[model samples]
Target chain A: MKLLELVALEKRYGERPVLRGVDLAVDEGERVVLVGPSGCGKTTLLRLVAGLDAPDGGEIRLAGEVVSRAGAVIVSPEARGIGMVFQDLALWPHMTARENVAFPLRARGVPRRERDRRVAELLELVGLPDAGDRRPAELSGGQRQRVALARALAAEPRLLLLDEPFTSLDPELADRLRGDLVALQERLGFTLLHVTHDREEARQLATRVVTLHRGHLGEEAR
Target chain B: MSRRLVLGSAVLLLAIAGGLPVVAMLAQAFFAGGRFDPAPLAGLLTDAGTWRLLGSSILLAAAVALAACAAGIPLGVLLARTDLPGRRLLAALFTVPLLLPPWVLAVAWAALAGREGLLAPVVGPGAALALDRFLYGPGGCVLVLGTAFLPVPLLLTMAALAEIDPRLEEAGRLHAGWGTVLVRISLPLALPGLLLAAVLVFLLALGEFTVPGFFRVDVFATRSLERFAAFYDVRGATAAALPLAAAALLVLPLESAFLGRRGAPLPGAGTRRRTVPLGRFRAPALAGVLFVAGVLVALPLSALAARAAAPGAFREALARAGDALPRTIAWSVTGASLLLLGGVLLGLVVGRRELPGWRAVDGLALFLFALPGAVTGIGLVALWNRPATAFLYGTPLVVLLGWFARYAALPLRVTTAHLRGIPPALEEAARLAGASWWLRTRRVTLPLLGRGLFLAWIVGYVFCARDTAIAMLVYPPGRDTLPVRIVTLMANGTPGMVAALCLLATGVVLLPVAVVLPVLAISGREDRR
Candidate 1:
């Protein structure tokens, strides 16, 4: 089954149409990577999928649930059960790695013990068990990415969204993390939609690659 | 063409608003006694009252500055660094005193600490234990002014604290503990800003006149005004003003020494998170915050409320205000409009064009920022209060000129800052696009500066409305601004009247906040750029 589907999604800023009609889909447990140059609506697509922004037209369906419909209902990010790691990481500076991972669980009203247990396991999963007490500011570029990933996975999300997550990390660390992420996804059996400008990263990580050009999405073989 | 016209118009308006009355005042002072006489200088220097007032003023200002620093710094740290409970509410509450005019706070404080005030019922008469005695002397002046001016340092320190890269704290947290993080990283980074804030608060406190006047404490400001208005000793008043002006000038060095190199941006941008969670000591901190807010806002408001409840007092005050309100409005509106116009013109001249003595002109405009209002009033009155200058005195023009001279800095500062932000390349581009200098300014520059001009006008208006010292000395018989009227009512022992009028006056002072807050909110949503 398709885990996520966008039908003729369009967005505009005043007279300028930033995202023209775009259609795309990702299968369940599939690793889909989006590649494009800057300002080619790559981040905009991610934001639309994450429900941070509303599309000017068309529909978005996630897990067979109609998440957005033009001129009708639109689901909020929290309600959509979609997890996102922003390009800038957007990690709450005040929260520790553990607390950040525990946030979605807390928001979903998971009990404190269970939340802590899940957070610890996730921190260990991301190889940052000891770093859980440190805030995002304390961590290195790569460590922060792991904390972000650990946070996104805390709610046991069906689909994970990563936007240029490894862009700020060192190349070696990025490659290592990419391998770890792929292994983690395979082990966890979760679908992933990642956005990056690097073609090499797309080839290395994606099962299927999609290219966004002037807001039009075209499937490309990895 | 339209934009240039608007720019020119705006400048013209500011000039008219700020310049004419100043010219009138100078004319009055210099030509009043058939010629300028330096005789009053000797009399002013010899007067024991003048010396006493100056000493008291300096002491009061120093005390207030210290008190403000003591309260403001800790609160700034707590608000910025900790996940203290109700931090947002506490931040907002702290700004309330800043919005209120000093005279309004003075009147409210008087009602609370006076002999017949709310505490009188609980403490009994002649109770040395009561705050009434403290409220009427040097102690009262410092307390009231300190509380009133605390927001400046609090804001500056908070901004500084927020700018500290959160990563540094996080690194410290990883290596050591929260205590170590705060001591080693946060406090050191925030020190420059805190010292800068202290200097700013001190400078502001030094110029304050209304609070001291309300407390019946003779300060330099009041003494200067008395010399001019009562004794008609123009030279004496001018001489009296020299020291205060010198003290005000002291701020320039302090500002440069402490704050010049520090480039910490305010906390409005780059803040990813809205709330920071508290780990421990939340409840006690919350209680302390609540207690401070209660004392600062609730106590004074309650005193005013009590006085307003008295029989016929509110009505009587309202009736008097009703009689005075139109004239007050006219004076403030006219004065501010003139000041804004003058400031914009002066700012534009200083900003875009290089001319002889332009730096001196700029300095003269900013000079009033440091000088106490009484000193400015004294200087103007001294220069204008002559037999030959009879045309300027006993006329509304003198008041208007004083308002302009005192407040031109607002528009000039705002305009210059705004102008600096608009890249010169834009103007060059317009020129490259076949636009004449006049056309480019009209179509491009003026339109861009609309918001700045509006804001400058609003600030100028608020300053004019809130000022009492300058208005008190220079106001002709027919023109009394709201603050002057409020001060007069307080001086005459009409606490009820004072409270009512002050409340009314404060609304005028805070009008700009109503407009500014919404614009800020909308802007915050639009850009992190």
Candidate 2:
């Protein structure tokens, strides 16, 4: 099944088109990586899919539901059950790992006991169970990325968006995390759309790769 | 290139102007009775009035600080975090009270809340009961001072809030609620900045003279001013000023200690982009913001406008002010120029080289910043009123010196900040190129510091123009500045004329700066955008 689909996406700032005539699709449980140079609409595409932004001209369908459509309807990120890890990790510097992991569940009005149970399981799954009580500031760069991942997965979203999530981490940790991410994705059966400027990171993590150049999506590869 | 030279010259001139009054005053204080008098020192410690004044001043300052913090913190949060409607308009309105002279605010408050004033018409017979009686006492002093100085904390809080990483709030939003986000993340991150702002506001409130004086509240500043103007007792006033100065000294260490702690890092690379929507609260919040702005900007201005429109008020005030306008402007401009010159020279001297006790010198320069204008005036009067120090007193020079001493901090701070931005390599390169010290400074350093110089001059000029406390005490007989003229006219029951003169004075002082500010703002916004 098509987990996510964007048809003829277009975005403009004033007179300048940022993202124009873009179409894409990702299958269930598939890890698709989008690669582009700066200002090439790679991040914009991820943002659109995550529902952080609205498309100027497009229909976005997730799990066979029309989430966003031109001149019709648009779903909020929270309402769409979409999880995103921004380029900055966007981890709450003030929250402990456990608390961060429990956030999305809390937002969904999960009870404290079940929230705690799920949070602990997610932390252990991310290989940071021991660091559950530590704040993001107290964690290493790689640990912070893990916390972000754990937080994103807390709500049990069907699809996940990662925007250069490992850019700030050391190369060795990035490699280790990429392996862990693939293993977790396989186990969880959650589709992923990851955006990165690093070709090596895209090549390593992607089951399918899509190249974006100057606001246009190029040939897709498997 | 010429602009740099003009800016450099202005800075150099203002510094000298700022320093002369303090120098003259200190000379007089030390040389009294042919030596520094111990009698005045004893009088200062033992006087009942002095202690009462000190206690009242401290209490008033504390009250004002708390009030300002309470008002400013929430407003700052609304501005920085929430997508409050008219946030831009509120931000601009918040700064209006800061620019208006304290005397103007006090008079407006008096007109509105005083007996037989505006509120009387609405409140009718039971008006006295409805209004707080203490509004003219220490309580009123605190209220006026707090309202006047609230913008400082508001500005500081906004700056601090802007620096906080928004992702912290998002993290909380994901886990808990907006309340959790505020208490756990926003408050803790903004605490240091808020506290620093509180301390500075407290210091300023403690030193304030005009509000207390107009409201019949007897704080240290008012008492010190009284001693000089009413009795010409310079020694007595100087002695009274000592305790307030000592209190200021105590606060200095505490302020530095708070500032030493690390603040939240500013939003930059790797920081999340998040703007919390105001949601349903948008309309009501915007209304609340607008109401506050209306009360702050409209109340005093309306009262002044009404007074200006009264029969013969505008014509009489303008006629009198017209005679004094040229002299006032000349004194303010000349004094500011001298102050700028001295500040730049001193800044270059202290900032460039690794001189022994440079830190101490910098500390001393900032020391007078804490002293109230009235206290400084009293000290100056004490020092210069002696026969031996007659050369510096009762002259136009005395008035100029008084303005310079009171406002020296402006140019000094500007020049010092500017000097720090210049690269040391440029100077080293100039030296290696065989340029003399004077040549390098004149050609390279002066050009680099042009903007700083212009800013310093403007700051000094505005401060000199608006200042009344020190200028009142030492304006020699017929050489009163605009503020002094307004104050004297108000005290003598010429309310209508005083209001007109104030509007004109404020306009004259603010117009040039106001005209340039938008251009500067546009350029700044363009750069950032």
Candidate 3:
């Protein structure tokens, strides 16, 4: 049931080695939180897994298929069926909340009626049913975060990556969202690979916690 | 009332100097013996020859704009988004053409491709003659003007692309390839700026007269000037210019409708900066950029330099220039200083968006900027040529007014953009300290906006120094700017003298830029440190 695998993945930016011979694997329906200091390559590992970047040296397998190898993306990002919510949410400012959530569905060639239904359903699930017509700029900070999460879930990917999703939120809101995320993941059964600097967020969100320090992984207590 | 008065005065000045003259020219074209008649207007518009000329002009502008975008966009992308080799030097070289006037480019091109050109000895007479023949038509105008204005799209594209949040593209990339992501996300975000650049290039090429005139291309811009000078007929000139004015008027609304007020919002925090990797294409891209820089910019300039290398060329040219050299310097400095002052006032008005009809004022300024110099010239003469207004009409003030009307948009845009980064609270705080408006402006606002105003002044000076049509049309007797003098003297002046004068004029424009850029760079470095 291994959904994603990164075997000795290596990445460097100029002379600086960010991810050196890093190896990790995530099974289906596992909530794996990655904690690291700034510049410790947690985001790099997420990007590599999501196929947004090619590794300098390594092989990445998805469902036992070689998706990337030796600085080449054998499988393109869209074909990888991976969803990522960036730290900033990165919602398209020009799009309404509904359109932002529906983008992935439209991209996947989902029918218009189904896409609308799914978008509405997702908006409702995120507690932003009334915000479908609003732009990212029109939404509150917490509302925008919900929209981003909804967007990431739109395509129904097997693996979902989160990079510091609640880093910008207040403690109360972050705790509330973390609880909601746990419920949603339990219901959906998608593998989660979340990166955050907050230890409490990791402890609360993860079934298993992994620490990435100086381009290597260290397992943490459950 | 004071704020209203301030904004109102600025708008009034624009209306009088820029708007009224154009209206006067249009009125003259459509009226005879104080009666409104469309007969003359219809006659001119219906003329086959007029249409032919306008058609040629449109074709030329379109071709130039198309060529500029075709080259400029790729260059912009490579320079801004890739780790291309020597990109910094290549960018600097490419922008050299923009510093000089279009006519100077035409002159440099002729020196490179004419029968008696630098290439004549190398390529032999027959091929040189063939090249010379090609240089005297629409093809030559497109090459010269396209090269001259290439920086418009180049710089704007870079600016546009720079403003896009990299995360937007990254988000798209998580579900798509770079190509699809670019098309769906990056390009859509950058399209407004790209469109604006293309429109600007088209307007500029359409308004261009000197290069077309030099090449004997007979575009509407030149034809309008020809009509005015040849027959002293304001009506005829206005008829020729109306097409360009109409085109400008049409484009103004379209630009606003498409671009809105948004200028590619600032990139967000934690957005990882990712460049488009040019893995295998790096060398080819660098070669392409360098090839363009060499052919379009370096070659012609080198030819001009060689031709002006005669021992006494500059000395003789300076001697012949007499008071023109000094006069050009004086006029440009005065014009730039005056423009900076006016631009600050107008910038505050437009940027704050507090005054009524500010958008209209802004649109009018842009319209004047886009209006052909010949049209503005014709309009100015019609409005100001009277015994009662002799003081204003007969002196250099008339030319200054024309400069103000023509180049107002430059300073205004600079100040407006600069004003966005400035907080209004500083001025409000000063005012709350019981300081008068003048005191707050002098102490708080002006001091803060100094660098932007300095940049505006330099831009104003560059345009003023190289200005031809406005000065050619409205300059008082014996008060022609150096550009006007060089343009007029190009026909009969010695090769060395003309080349030297071109170099001298270019030098005058670059002098301030050379001084300011390094100072700014040092200041920037200091600030960074």
Candidate 4:
């Protein structure tokens, strides 16, 4: 079943057209990796999908409900039931691992006891149970990556969007995190729409791979 | 043009506008006639009266800074971080006092708390007497100057908060509400800016003369002005100004050593900023903002309005000080234009660190900025009142030069900050495309800086127009700005007439911003599209 759909999406900054009349879809429990060069509208597409930005022209539907259309957002980002791990790994530097992981639950009105249990479970699942009290700044790069991943999954998002989340890590660390991510996805059974510049990364994690070139999506390769 | 030419031009401009005046003043102080003399300088420095005045100035400045920061920080958080209603309007309202001369606030407060003032009817005469007494001393000086300078920390806080990596907030948003995110993420990140604001407020309040002078509080700034304007004692004025200048000079290094690196760009500095929703608390937050605005801005302005409502008050103001308006406009325009030119050139050289001594140049300009307007005016007169420079000194050029000396830092800082926000790659790409330095700066750099330059020009114009201390000291006879005119007329002018003049001066200062900001906003929107 389709979890997310984009119909002829378009975006522009000034006179510079970024995303142009692009159509795409993602299915439940499937990993779709989008490969594109920098500034080719990969992040723009992710932001549009996450409802952080409205398209200049197009419609974004999640779970068959329109979330965004040309120049307007029907559903705000937090209500879109989508979790994004930004390229910068955007962990709140002031919050400890446990607090960061528990944030989504708290936002959704989860009680403190249940929130704590869920946060601890998420931390253990992310292999950082012992690092729960450590802030993002005190954690290692890879540990920080794990914390971000844990935070993203804390709310049990229906669709997870990763915008080159591991790009900053060394190849060795990135490779390990990608492996851990795939295992987590398999265990959690969540739909994934990931963007990357690494073809090897796409090969390792994608159930299906598509290339974005000059604002057009190429045929999917499984 | 070559880099050498650019550096040389900046040096010459700085020397003429800022450096030479200070050097000439110090030279005059240390040399009697043609020979070096230290006795007079030494005697003046050691005077008990001088120390007492300096102590009073320091205490006043410190109190004002603390009070401003205390009020301003929370106000900034509300305006910048929260989803407060009328945030933009509230911000603009709070900024009104900063654009006017600080003494306007003193005048407004006095009118509100005086014997026949607004509060007298409201609180009855007995309590009003106590408030009146409080309004005319050190406490009153702090209240007026603190309110006048509050926008420094408030605006700085907003700017700093705006510069935070929004992604951090967004990540927080995905999990928690805005209240948590602001407390945990946004305010912590913006702490450096808040601290910088406190330091700036302290310096500004210390250097302020008009507010303290109006309240009958004798700080060093007033002493410096009194010695020169009242007694024509150049030596005494120079002696009075030396400690203030030294104090400002010391702060330069401390600011450099402490807060210099705090402004380094955050990772992902240019990302889209997201606003926190006020949600259920919007009405209360808005009411709180309005209350603060009412107390700080509206109440005082309303006093001026009520007083000025008398028949023919504005006409009387125009009749008495009407000529000063045209002179104010011309000088402010000329001063702002010159400041813009000097600012852009200096901003580029210092911001890009193209010269080895850019830090020193930057520090020197900032020290001049922190130096009281009276000090800069004294310096300019000492430098230009010679037979050879009589043509320059006897005209309005001396006044314009004093303005450039004191307030050039506004445009310079604004331009430098704006330049920093533009990525180096834009210019480097032009360079790689075979563009010369001049061509790259014109085509690639300056276009990106258009909004910033416009903003700087407006700020420069307002400061030049509203200046009291420097204009009073250095303006050629019959060439005073509106602020100086108002100060001159205050002694014998009726209360209604004085209030009318203050309102007219405010209108003049606001007219450009009111006309330009909307146009800039529309242009900004068009650019975004």
TM-score of each: 0.63, 0.78, 0.83, 0.80
lDDT (C-alpha) at residue B107 in model 2: 72
- Residue-level lDDT of model 1, residues A1-222, one tens digit each, is 999999998877566776788888899999999999877888777767866556789889998888876644367566667677767665655568887788678767799999899999999999998998897778999899899888888888788888888987889999999999999999999899998999999999999999988778876885
Which regions of candidate 1 fall more than 4 Å away from where they truly are? A1-222, B1-53, B78-92, B123-129, B159-193, B257-259, B262-277, B342-363, B386-394, B413-431, B434-454, B515-529
Candidate 3 local Cα displacement, residue B491, angstroms: 1.7
Candidate 3 per-residue C-alpha lDDT over B1-529 given as tens digits, one digit per residue, 9 for 90 to 100: 3666765776777788899999888888889889987675688888898888788788889999999999998788778777787776777777878878889889888888987889999998889888999999888999999999999889878877776778788887776666666666776677878888888889989999899888987877887787789988777778778888988885577557444626443554324567777879888877777788889998998898888887898998898777888898899999898788787778888887757787887888888988888788889998899899999999999998999899888898888878876788988899899987777777887777767887899989988888888898999998888898899899898887888889998998889889897787677678656
lDDT of 1 at B488: 68
Q: Clashing residue pairs, candidate 3? A: none
Ranked by TM-score, top first:
3, 4, 2, 1
Worst 10 residues of 1 chain B by lDDT: B265-274
User: Which lDDT value does model 1 have at A40?
Assistant: 82
Each candidate's interface RMSD: 11.7, 4.0, 1.9, 2.3
Winner on TM-score between 1 and 4 is 4
* Top TM-score hit: 3
Q: What is the DockQ of each candidate?
A: 0.03, 0.21, 0.44, 0.33
Model 4 spans > 4 angstroms off = A1-84, A91-161, A168-193, A206-222, B1-3, B24-53, B250-271, B420-426
* Candidate 4 lDDT by residue in tens digits, B1-529: 8976976686577778788888888887888878888655788778898778778788889999999999898888888877788888899999998998887788888889877788999999899999988998998989899999999889988987877777878776655556767877788777767776787788788888778777778777777777787898887778677777777775576556434434433555225776666778889888888988899889988998888888999999999877898888888999999888887788887887777788877887888888778888889888888799889998998888888878878888898889878988999999999999989988989999989999989989999988888888888877778898899888789999998999888888888989999998899899876
CAPRI-style grade of the A/B interface in model 2: incorrect
Off by over 4 Å in 2: A59-74, A77-82, A90-140, A143-158, A183-190, B1-55, B78-87, B128-134, B165-187, B226-239, B246-280, B319-324, B334-371, B375-460, B473-477, B518-529
**Top lDDT model:** 3
